[model samples]
Target: MEASSEQPQSVSVHLARLVIFSAVVLGLIVGTLEVTLEYKKLRTTLFEHSEQVAKAFEDIAARAAANRDRSLAEEVATGLLEFKSIASVEVSDETGTVLAWKECGQVEAFGSWLPFEIPSAQHTILLELSTPSSGGEAKGYLKVTASSAQATQIWASQLGMVLISVLFGTALLAGTLLFITHLYVSRPMLRLAEAFRRLDVSDPKNSPLPDPEMFRFREFREIAENGVRLMRDIKRNSEVRDLTANELYRSQKRLQDFAEISSDWFWESDRDGGITYISPSFTKTLNKKTGEVYGRTIAQTTAEPVNTPKWHKLGEIQRQRRQFRDFRYDMAIQPGEVKTVSINGRPFYDEDGTFIGYRGTGADVTNERLIAEARNEALQRAEQASRAKSEFLATMSHEFRTPLNAIIGFSSLLSMPELLKAGVDRVTEYSTAINDSGQHMLALVNDILDISAIEAGKRVLTLEEVEIDGLLSHSLSQIESQAGAKSISLIVEQNAQVGTMVSDERSVRQILLNLLSNAVKFTPSGGEIRVTVDEIGKDIVFRVADNGIGIPSDRLPTIAEPFSHSAIHPHVAKEGTGLGLSIVRSLAVLLDGGFTIESEVGTGTTVTVRLPKNGSGASGEVQTA
Candidate 1:
């Protein structure tokens, strides 16, 4: 399966997560230890300071007691109360009489116990005041109570600040580590992966392996270098495989070419005798010029007498899954045409030895059979051609005389001076009739001469750069008057992309004009004519369509022959020389183009001409005589 295109998490992110998590854990442990130790140290220092203050006031208390002054002792105790941790202090005489006492109300006790009844380190301490005399006995004991609430609060605050610092430091450390990893590891790895992913295996010489020397770490750099080495090896193997595949393809092609050359036709059929594949040469031998005969049974393609003894024997052989060699049979393709072919076929089986199809080669033996009867066929063909020529001459004589007689009769009438004397208008009408007859005769003669020249291979072309849009417009304009007389709307649709083409301008223009004229001439009153010019690939296409009296489908094949007129459009008044399409077809061939016509009687007709955009530089012009 293909990998997702989404950018994935890098090694830097994963490492950052692990390192940041470890830093957070370590910070918590260190912060707890430091806060605990700080709480203990603050408690010890507070007690010691309280003891020292009480001792310093001992001498003052003794003097006060000796002087019998209680007020002075109270002042000493009041001075000690200034300390924040000191809750209260008291001075007593040797008789255990309370002489002075001082209390500080600002101190609030949090507690001596923590959660779960654990004893806290915070506590108060009492100290005694002793005389400096020889007895060194205690004159009065100073009472000191340290609440430790303030000290505990300070510790909590310090711990909070320390925790914040640890968090901030961990975040900064994580970011720094991520940046370093990306620079040294993740980025280089990503580049190597991308380069490998983009490597095209189909082209080994042009596609080089990526360089791994960019990595800073030795281990990763080693990995990249090894990857490059492996890729070089793979590329070498791929080149070898490519060479082998190309050689194999050439061998297969040579065998195919040999088979095609050796036999007149090659074919294959399914186990059910349905044709699967037939070569173009095979179809041409069968007199089928276009389309395919695949998926058809032999009985359907063969003549009506398909149950002959020879075919029966072939069927029996196929039923037994046996190979047949040099099996000759006659195939009647069309009336008056019978072909004899010798075929050699073998049943093809799949890997499991199950019958799949039959592959075969066939040679048309009709020519061999003809050689045996060539003398008889020659005599018959000669007689047939003679008869056909006589009939053609008779028909052509009638066709020529009709137009010649019209011209002669009209010219004779125009030659009379009496018609001119009758009126100038009358003379002008007769002159027009003579001119029309002369044009008809000229068109007939031109068609014959053009066909003869084409058969003699005398056509040549004058190539030029042709403006396609202008040519289409000119052709349509020339046929506009004729279409107007028939009340037919003439339209030209030119693609903007088909601005200009290189072709024989005269032949291209004449081809378009002939098609347009035919559309205008045959279409009924109120019919429509459309001409479209466009460029498709390397070719330029011109299609002329008309809602006219269309030709019969069967007569379409013979429409390109000279003097062949369609009998389907009997209602069309003006008779054509029937050479317009013939001349256009010839011109298309000369220019190395294609021509095709599609028509359905009583419906419409569409004529298409496809010519290469680049005109021929050789002899492509059809010289009309």
Candidate 2:
């Protein structure tokens, strides 16, 4: 069904109608109120007049009642009825016997002529027939009733005058407003509308608006001037729009060509999210036919559940009909094969602004995903390395300072005049202390140099046949004093049949020293340390187990890393340089040996080093047990 197109009313007619309606309604309200107030005043005046008449007839009625003369009472009542407002008069004695009764027929006749009856007002007065010396006694009553019909008739006449005046004023006001509006607003607006109607927007440059000076009022003149400026702007915009349209067409063509050749595919879906149209690039990228995807929903084709957070967010965007960019998800191209897909899309709507579906471009971003992952991994490693370096420097500073401070303090003590003069025994003690500090500092520097050389692939290994028992004894002897200091028991389990192995003697000795030193450092008083050696397959395994404060499982992975001691045991005193385990791992690797650590918090730690009997120059991998 077609809608009817009604011709719109002009501004002048609409304004005139509005003015007439408003003025009439306001006038009616005011007129009605005035008439009501005037009626009330008239009613009050009539009532007052009735009361005055009754009072005047009271003395005459009293005298008549005292004398028991009906004629005199009748005369009083008849005189009271003479007033036009008085409808009826009645006289009664103290005994309730009526002396006179009279009523004017004119009031009844007037009320009958009216469509509605008016209620009358009545007044009564007591007649006193007593001397001045005595209190007054009512001898009779005089009553006068005033008909409200007269006041009502007067109100009606006044109401008619008010209504007539209101109509005249309302009409006059409406006509005046209409004339003024037509001359100033309506006529100018009509001219402007006519000018627009005749305007050819295609040739707006030539179809200029009428001059603003033609209007009489300033507001109309300004409006006309604004219209002229608006037309000028329209003309300018029209020319620009034409150029933009041409450029936009070319840009769209270029975009279409790019979309066809690009590896990324374009797709469109219906409101139900079912695939409707997909570009050829989709098949080329995903190795799938477009027909296979057509009936499938986005969730099905994308290989993700709608309940997943990414799809849930995408659903929310679609529900809101909002645009989305770089929406990434995984799609399965084949069994056991998945590709990360990134898409950019916007909700498409019909000309009437009803959402039809979504249209977007997508690409298989598998390679980009892998690259991003690699980049992130590298970044994390860099951060870890940076942190390790910072910790290493801090540990080195403390480690170096401790011995340096000891050497300085002891040397100062040895040089003291009073101490030297005391005895040679005191001087020898200070000298010995200084020598110990120097030895400790030397060991710290050697360890750092060893680690750096091994890392730089510059460490040369001296491979030789070394007795297992002698090597174990030497390593044990180096840490015996440290173990005795803590009262920790040291135990060794050696296989008598395992005689000797060809390996780097210095690297092996350093590894055993570091492992044993760490045990003594961490072990509590009365704790036990065990060293075990066994030949397995082509490799010889050395295990150092300690019943000491152990590493937390989470730190096990990076515990062998340089300077990780501070991170692992943050609450422990900063004693060692935190490079013992790292050095052990590196040396083991350089000798083609595998190093492993197994630990549990509050339990204990076990470190295993397995070296090939015949040393290999190639580096080995570290393993966590």
Candidate 3:
């Protein structure tokens, strides 16, 4: 396309030619004018010089002619001829008789400035010589002829210089214009044309239009920018048109496929409710003959001794000349398996509005109906999951912020002058509160990190043989202060026979501490919290029971899920982060263990952890009940 728009002359050539031609014409005009003016001035100078010479020798020539001294008169003429510009000199007596005459070499017919020979008469000047100094009478006439060679040579030299300068300047100007046009205009235009030609039509997105910034000329830049915009618009339009055409084609193809398939079929009936035409695909679906069903009512062809309200309703519509759509019915095709079909129909009318017949389509929609139901169920589940996550984030925010607020508030109070003067006990109390808040925050952070690590498969258990008795002792000791602060009783019981189990000590300790702390927090003052360790078969069992607020039986199923606090115990307001139970469950899995929780609303709650006696089996085997 760009190639076809090429002009015979490029812009640079056109500009250069125009400017050079103008310069030549101007040079010629100026040179001609200068030569003409100089020639006139030369003629006037020659004539004036000739007249002065003739007058100077007037007295001498008159004296010589009066005495008839021909030698003396000839002497003066010869002296005048000494100047090369004087081509001829003639001196005659007062009677007009020629006395002395001299003539030198003839001037050339053609000189530098003049294209043809100049007339010798034009350069010749004749002056009268008044003989006596005081007398006006002429004794002789002096005719002097000055050759124009000197003047012509001078004019030719000047004109040659002027023409040389003009030619040089014109060439320079043309060269400079060509250079600038090629650099800033022509080159960029060619590059842009090439870019447009090479643009990939298959992937318009990847093919970018030429950048206007790449050009030096303002007009070219503007043109490039507008061209790019136009190309982009064309690309977008092309994409949209292609997409629409593709969609249209797909729709048509789908319709054609549907028309050819036996899954969905078309049928027509008369106003009398008798089957007039049944599509071949419809007969194939029923595994029956089209001839068998022709002219028969729908109830007569495939009717069975079963509930078919759709048929009855369709018959009523036919009698009333009304339209019915997507009326579902069950057809017990031969051998007792029912195939549910949904049909749609509209009553047709003639020109005069008389009822003609009914025409519609039907499909075996049993599988489609089942699929739609499954999708609805999946959507409902997704919505529920989304709601659960939202609630979890809200609850977790409160859980995290509570400790942060406490830590900040108490730390600020600890800096008070009054508290400093109040003495050590108050300082210690504030310090303890800060410490507890800090620990709570740390636990929350750890739980989140741990769960994330487990989910990402980065959580590895460093297993070792850990004594059950020592673990129990350490867990109980850590939470004893917490229990004491609440005035809750702590009980520890363990079986000596249940010795040691290979497991991650840190994880087990975390599990124990979390459960014991929960017990301490929830158990009212004076209530008992027991930590019992025993052996059950190949697993070592640890149970932490507290006579605190317990969970209802209905909430047990989802209790182990992260942030399932609200779902677990909707009415009870729990203080601890909901992550504790979830973390414990995850850790139990990581260390090859089983975890369970049994609770009654007002009675108490007991959480049990069972780990494999030896960590020989694969870790991350968690069973919860």
Best of the candidates, lDDT: 2
lDDT string, candidate 2, 1-625, tens digits: 9777998777788888899999999999999898888888888888887777777666677788777789998898788877877777777777878888898885434334446755654544444443233358777666666777778777777777888899999999999998898877777888877766776888887785778888777887887788788888988999899889999999988877887799999999998888898888888888877898896777787666668787888888888889999988888788888888898888888999888988998888999999999999889778877888887787778878988999999888877788968898888888898998899899888878877888887887777787888999999999999899889999999877778988878888999999999888877889999999999988889999999888877778887887665543565444766789999999888887899999877678899999888665435332211
| Runs of candidate 2 exceeding 4 Å displacement | 1-256, 282-308, 331-339, 349-356, 366-375, 493-497, 617-625
| C-alpha RMSD for every candidate | 28.3, 23.7, 37.0
The candidates, ranked best first by TM-score, are 2, 1, 3
Clashing residue pairs in candidate 1 (N, C-alpha, C atoms within 3 angstroms): 460-621, 461-621
lDDT of candidate 1?
0.75
lDDT of 1 by residue, 1-625 (tens): 9999999876767888888999889888888798889988887877777767666776787776555468898887788787776778777776778888888885444433334322334344555556577277666666767666667767766777888898998888878888888888778788778877877767766776777767777877787788788778878898888889999999989867865566577779998988887766676567764244578756656654757887788889899999999977677766788788777899999999999989888778888888967967787656644643454455557667877787788678778877777888877776787777778678777767876777677766666778887787788788778888888987778787888877778778889988988888778899998888888988999999988888877667767765555433456435555668888988887788899999987889999999988764225333322
Q: Is 1 or 3 the stronger prediction by lDDT?
A: 3
Residue range 1-625, candidate 3, lDDT tens digits: 3567655776667776887788778777877787779877876787677667766777777777666678988997898887766778887877887778999876554444545655433467777766556378776677877776666655667667777787887778767877887787778878778778767777777787888888777887888888888778878988898999999999978866776675678788887768887676776676666677679766665545424675567677778877787877666666666666788888888999988888888877768777988999788657755766776777778878898898889899998888889899988998999898899788777877887787676776777878778888888888788788888988778887888887777788889988987777668888998888898888888899999878778777767776665533455656655667888887777776788999987889999988888776635532221
- By descending lDDT, how would the candidates be arranged? 2, 3, 1
Between prediction 1 and prediction 3, the one with superior TM-score is 1
- CA lDDT of each candidate? 0.75, 0.81, 0.76
Q: Pick the candidate with the highest TM-score.
A: 2
Runs off by more than 4 Å, candidate 1: 1-29, 40-80, 88-145, 160-202, 208-222, 237-263, 269-274, 289-292, 297-323, 327-332, 335-342, 347-356, 366-625
